[model samples]
Target: MIETAAREQRSAEPVVRPVRPRKLGKVPFVELADGRLQGVVSSGSDLARVYVSSISAATHGFSCSTNNNRPCGGLSGGSPCKHLRALADEAVLQYGLDRVTRYLRVEAGDDDDLMSRLDGTREAAPAAGVFSRFLRHLAYLELPGSTAPIAEMHWFPAVSAEVR
Candidate 1:
């Protein structure tokens, strides 16, 4: 579910820019992690499949592959595929435009969107590490909610609410 609370004013809290959450139907997991905007994105053609996608900050080096490590067929065109686009769109929804563009080190030109400004080259990166972390997050969701904190949750980064 998207955070409706993100719409409320936080004027008293001293926040210069407030976050705006969005409901991501295709992107179940997204994070500004590992110096990139990375997450698990559902396949458009198959319900049982997903792609691990990431766009590196500044350099915007990109990668998209199946959990088993097969490269996406869409990458040969020298442009970002649908999966990578969805990942960026959802990243903006989750992190807000200002924060995401800043993290990606992208400077706006005209009214162009985030994807258009990205200058990236496909780099084959390992899918296992990101997939592994997403799995851990899903596992935590299976636990019963309790007031008492779990010891391991302490190690979770406080940077974003999606992880918690």
Candidate 2:
């Protein structure tokens, strides 16, 4: 059923990025939790956790890593790799114009209201079952990385059922 469909989607090859940045697809389903914007993108048959952190003092800007425990090729050595950029583009698209415009006005800083809401969400525990798993998977991004945290002002209405 749902598991089979998700597996099928995961098995599909990752969308090839053009030589230059271009719209690849809609933001792969994402969530704002624990003061981070998190999403899992399939790289070939592997799952990579991609995230933007909201903590101002953190070291890195963004990071991506696969389920197999490999750092994203782009994120290694603190580079702004294509994978990270694609994920950000997707997130902005998902966030929409109104939010992006506001995010821009704030200089993508932590002071934005949207960031505050998401950061505050950390105080409230994530729901049980699916949400917990989704949080766990996304939480992997918090491991040592090159980026600082930034709140995800745009809230995803509901958790994606894709978490297994």
Which candidate wins on lDDT?
Answer: 1
Any runs in candidate 2 off by more than 4 Å, and if so which?
1-27, 44-60, 97-164
The residue-by-residue lDDT of candidate 2 on 19-103, one tens digit each, is 2233533334344344444554545433343322221112223445553344556544554445444544555556543444343
RMSD of 1: 8.0
lDDT of 1 by residue, 19-105 (tens): 556776699999887888899999988998999998888589899999888998888787899999999888877777777888889
User: Model 1: what TM-score?
Assistant: 0.75
Q: What TM-score does candidate 2 reach? A: 0.38
- By summed lDDT, the worst window of 10 consecutive residues in model 1 runs over 10-19
Residue 38 CA displacement from its true place in model 2, Å: 1.1
* Count of residue pairs whose backbone atoms collide, per candidate: 0, 11
Model 1 misplaced regions, further than 4 Å: 1-19, 147-164
